[model samples]
Target chain A: MDGIDKTDRKAINFSEKLERISDLWQPRVIAEMNDYQFKLVRIEGDFVWHDHPETDETFIVLEGVLRIDFRDGAVQIGPGEMFVVPKGVEHKPFAENEVRLLLIEPRGVLNTGHAGGNRTAQNDRWV
Target chain B: MDGIDKTDRKAINFSEKLERISDLWQPRVIAEMNDYQFKLVRIEGDFVWHDHPETDETFIVLEGVLRIDFRDGAVQIGPGEMFVVPKGVEHKPFAENEVRLLLIEPRGVLNTGHAGGNRTAQNDRWV
Candidate 1:
């Protein structure tokens, strides 16, 4: 078998990857496309208001509800739904129950953005 | 209500968007982040063997089964699974049944890459 390795060519399963994470709000990188990374995260409760001044953030909900509050309004995303929070807009993500999410953004972007605090998770963490 | 318009801040539901597309293999842009675009497409047959020399391509399966065949191997992606086809790697996607997918790539990339023909879809079509 001189071709692409079978084990290395498997698809990244979201549910399987999410099961490897126990901590909330910590995003674990699963795949990358060019300079962007696709991360899987689980969260409940409120997140700090922050803005990725350099890039837009995408949130695709896999399970439960995710509400992202902007300064003027909010968007509630459920399973099979997604939203793109534009760059430089301050937003806060809140979940009443556990929510599984797939976040897509540039590689170096932090979880807390510029709001950096105790809630900030380490960057480049892969599952 | 001078805030973010409620009507304009709704989430993009994958199932709802897929319902609007009756054609197969035509990816319609649903959202954008920076220079990249997120597209939704329904496919049920074989696609042309092609390669994106400028960037990688991401395929996130929302429904049904999708198998991407590389020159030497293949990756089977099902619902909740994803695979990124690296730049310059020739591949063909096939599906036994209808498959709904979320494709992420740079804005100008075509569905058929450089292997353009009748199968090539119109670029920048939004849903």
Candidate 2:
């Protein structure tokens, strides 16, 4: 990414990723380089209880409301308000309606942090 | 930059930079980690000719029209249509009205690539 001089960093669209993945709750890699990954995830309702063991992931609400529930309290974010969940913190993210989110995290970030549950999707297929 | 776990990259507002720099035409760094830089620039009217020697900068029009004049042709982008100028291309950017743009480039991106002429500001001061 260091060579991305003003002339070299071309503007790229993230729409192509949206078309690739259909199922909800799974995140697909849209852009990646080295250890970083930019993923697009479509979510609805509440997700399984999980926690990342190694990396902290960022969630940017692209369209709808996102509620991140923590041990202490819950945070609600709209199209813009962003909250950073601490690493290894147990959390659950839910949305009332289908919401598009841009997730930034390191490579190898697992969708189900704590493994299988009723809400966990079967495939982590790249879309 | 790799360590920017989603937890670490807390949602930060770009409004702070918007307040610090009142003068037009100057780009200020609002966020930086390693080589990547997110800059905010407020613009008005037409600007002098300039070019980047190494990097290809990505410009996202946050507010108004941004017309880029190249030797071969011209391109006007509004809102989200992004175009990347190749390395070492001489061009002049102009705006018929006041505009705000988010510039993404590597560190050390100079505002005036071709030195003083008319639109060149006296300083490239960081806000």
Candidate 3:
């Protein structure tokens, strides 16, 4: 369904959305373009190692730092930067402090990918 | 074709990429996740009324303000904000000053969409 109505279709402020939630690692679906979903999540500490076999996941850091540990190495992402985990490559994202970032992925794709755990958030939860 | 090597897959700074180009309306591909591409563009003045019939377009404002005029109404998107123009709907994006933003769309979609003009930029150009 096209949700471009007057109420929520206005300029979605990032800080405003981030302030609305205190839970970490739970992605809040903010907007959708085509079949892809734009999600915002505040995550800290370690995450489950997983891989999405069908789609790549994009991460755009808005605040703090994020360290994505790959199978062989790790990449540290800073604020105002981004990184993408390719399809089928297992990765675990970690952050020392609270980090806010935006995730872009196809609709219905699980956050933990093939690794189902307590950290696996419900898909399509909006803030 | 996975470009997640140690070189370009690192964190991409938006301000650095926006500084690399002075041309308006041209989108520079910074990173790719699956079939979608993350592009940075700077735009000012007015753009042609266009619509991507095959896919929707996403615009994330990094600096300045963006006004998107739709068929029925218009939207003003500011820095740290975003707006998604639905598919098959006509829209014209304008800004009084240069606006820096990120655009996520499929790899081959043109900027001008069906309303091709001199403002049509070369796709897949990286900064």
Q: C-alpha displacement of A34 in model 2, angstroms?
A: 14
Candidate 1 global CA lDDT score: 0.93
For residues A43-115, could you state the per-residue lDDT of candidate 3 as single tens digits? Answer: 9999998888889888999999999988778888888888888888888999999899999999999999978
What stretches of model 1 exceed 4 Å from their correct place? A1-6, B1-6
lDDT: worst 10-residue window of model 2 chain B: B1-10
Best by TM-score: 1
- Predicted candidate 1 versus true structure: per-residue lDDT over A20-124, tens digit per residue: 999999999999999999999999999999988889899999999999998888889999999998888889999999999999999999999989899999999
Per-residue lDDT over B1-127 for candidate 3, one digit per residue giving the tens place of the 0 to 100 score: 2435666446788888888988888899998887889999999999999888888889999999999997778899998898888888788899999899999999999999978889899889998
Q: Native-contact recovery for every candidate? A: 0.72, 0.10, 0.67
Better of 1 and 3 by TM-score: 1
Clashes of each: 0, 12, 0
DockQ of 2: 0.14
Every model's DockQ: 0.56, 0.14, 0.60
In the predicted model 3, the residue pairs found to clash are none
Model 2 chain A weakest 10-residue run by lDDT: A1-10
